[model samples]
Target: MDSGDVDFAHTDEAARKRRDKAVGLARYVWDRGIGGPELLALPDDRLRKLARAAGANPPSTRETWSVVAEMLDEKSRWAAVHPDDPRAVPAHADEKIMWVKPPLPPWPSR
Candidate 1:
């Protein structure tokens, strides 16, 4: 293959990796019940901050839902273009974002 072809392949793989990460993160936020009309009302700056805090690129559009949709759509497009590629959602994705509370200390022994 030509050097150009090799460069293109590397670029495509990087894009795929980025899309996969965004999709996982979007799902994590969705699982946490973090979206709705209230979030939509947030100013663009705040929305961008929230996205950044969630480890996502700041949305190009003002709507947070659009950010989630954009992330998901990119993954879907990749899957469509590479039908043989394994497209499984990462197992236990929520575990990455879960904030498990520490259990109370065992009751004092009598």
Candidate 2:
């Protein structure tokens, strides 16, 4: 096979690996109920190490970071409803912003 074909195959394999890892991580988080704040609080190096230990095959550094961010978001939303949960609300003020605009009715008021 040509070098281009070889590279494509390798890329495909990597993508599949990443997808598998993400799914696994998602399942673990779902089953364990480990809050996202805990994950976000981890240092980048530490997070990467945890991912490796968790058997994640992140396709790229960017993707790895994104996964961490997603975990945090999920944890935050869950915690918001679970008062006893320890996960703090997301720190980003913008993320917490809720518009006060009135909701439109299904039909115009007569």
Tens-digit lDDT track for model 2 on 1-110? 77556655348787776666766665444333444554455456655655665577433555644564576566557767886754443333242112112346798669
Cα error, candidate 2, residue 29 (Å): 3.3
Model 1 lDDT at residue 48: 67
lDDT of 2 at 22: 67
lDDT of each: 0.54, 0.52
Q: Which segments of model 2 are wrong by more than 4 Å? A: 1-10, 32-41, 56-60, 68-110
Per-residue lDDT, model 1, residue 69, is 51
Error of 2 at 36 (Å): 5.3
Q: Candidate 1 has which clashing residue pairs, if any?
A: none
